[model samples]
Target: MSRGTRAPRAVRAAAVALALAAGTVVAAPPAGACACGGLVDGPAYDTSVSSETAVLQWDGTTQTVLLELDALSNAPEVGLILPTPAPAEVALADPEVFRELDALTAPRAVVSDHRWWPELGFGSGSDGAGGAAGVAVLGEVRLGPLDVTTLGASDAGSLGAWLTERGFQLPETIQTALAPYVQDGWSFVAARLAPEEAATFDGTLQPLRVTFPSSSLVYPMRMSAVADDTQSTRTYVLADHRVDRVDPTAEAYEPTVRFAGRVDPATVESAELAALLRAGGFVTSHEQVFTEPGTEIVSDFVFAPAAADVAYTPTYSVVADRRIGPFFAGPVLAFAGVLALAVLVIWSGRRRRAPAPTLAPRPAGA
Candidate 1:
């Protein structure tokens, strides 16, 4: 139940207190409005050679989102398209918990280290200004020069038209492949540009690619803030789970663990414990059995490393059925000791009785 994104209680409380601390004051609306919600209307720039870039900064008081169009080899008509504020999605390490900082103006403040330029909408299209029929929605709003070819209500089509009209070209092969998804996936699609070559005023757009693990892998989604820093970074890792080797009870069990701090998985040593179990005729596999402190390990006998730095106290449940044999040497030696004692006592009593019998014969002869 706690697996989803949850905001820290203290963080949520502070956010509420901060909101209450600020007195409610309404400000005037932004300068000019565009059909795609809130649009910034300005002179059209001939950005044929450079890429378009928008930089947004949000302080406690105001949010400033700046758009820069680079005039490179082929310039297209560029516009900042803002839809009526849709719900913003913020990813958290734990999805179940909702944090308040994310709910507020944080989206307006993309971290400097992780700075990114998102796609804004178009200037007035085919029928001039205020035409609800054609509005450009540039999908992948990254470093690359967007090629807008369609002018319609949807941001994707309009952005495409804007790019094509200006001299930007889309490969027929890629266009054909994306034709089916033009309606749905286009909104989530944007081209990636090289990070090192990206600039605020350059028309040359860079391409970016991100890879995520498949669902079957057990991975950790971690988020933490550095000292004296306002931004937090979230990272995901695919690590093999292991049990505590010293504790025989936990040898075969593996559980996913979360640490308040960072842990280096490369230095972990549970391979030896797995080897020991194999020696005892047990097979081991890396499958998550529980959401506990240690890594998940499945085996016949207990499996864990001899020395491990345990991050949390864990409870292990093991159901073991073993056969005990009568040939055990300790019990056999104990039974032999008792039998020798009985034989010694019988011999002492017999010697005492035999002497009495001889004495009785002597008395009769006398």
Candidate 2:
């Protein structure tokens, strides 16, 4: 669900890229306020491929980003990118964490009335390798086949030129797609496969976990326009408060939210995550899925955590404007109550309308 996100131009929410086709462009980046650059191959790489799905977990101080990307093409090299609000500490994360989280936060199906006659069943469910002339180094590390480099650049033009100069191939559209970020002055990361590990990649990329200091949980997605394919992401926010979308003023911004109840203490695996959930009953979960249409991508998923002093008040899942319950009976019961009240009102009105019985017979007798 999380793609917080980058480009062939950057390693955004994890935006690394590789060549898709001879004419394709690629980019990597995930940040706020902009400032990006790249070579001509930059745009082609950025546009070539899209991450099918991602899982994001944020507990205020730490953000764990995990993604499942298709296995790489049999190319000589593949590039990865990640962009963050602050310098990030990254390492390989367990892929199982994502599978567990996905199952944990999926939208629940409700069967309000289970009739005895039938049994109904329902179910649901980067780094960098940055190198260039005039590029200021930020950080660099290697995880698996990726050689990561993080850096800062003055503008997209220079960043573009640098990426091209550093032996990174560029697509024709790289410049136009990356202008805004370069203008916004954001930092980027570049990741490439180690030569020895290149051809042997099994198509399935291992999930990577990145943690950085951000005032709140925010996923940078401004550079997604470089890709020609549809983009989709699911974000799981584990904090006291609910999570939502940023830059609401944008006409096309919309995402669905679900309150994935408190983590049962017995079920949690990570001691640290469990401790965070155990300390306060206020600890709860929220998930938002962005099904962004294949248009110019905008907005970032913004998650706001619960205050340390407050406790959680449960709210059901939201799809569009509808709210599904903590256990699925809430709305059903409310509707039944409304129906009962309407029936009572109609009965009372009927009784009142019946004219009082006349005493005409008694009066005649008198």
By TM-score, the best candidate is: 2
Worst 10 residues of 2 by lDDT: 18-27
Best by lDDT: 2
Q: Tell me the deviation in Å of residue 97 in model 1.
A: 26
Candidate 2, 50-115: lDDT as tens digits:
333344455556555544443222223334444455556666655555455556655555444332
What does candidate 2 score on TM?
A: 0.59
Tens digits of lDDT, candidate 1, 187-292: 2112212223223323222211111211121111110000111211111121122232222223444322322112232222344222222322111122122232
Off-target runs (Cα >4 Å) in candidate 2 are 1-64, 71-75, 109-133, 249-251, 270-296, 305-366
- Residue 69, model 1: lDDT of 24
Q: After superposition, how far is residue 117 of candidate 1 from its true place, in Å?
A: 59
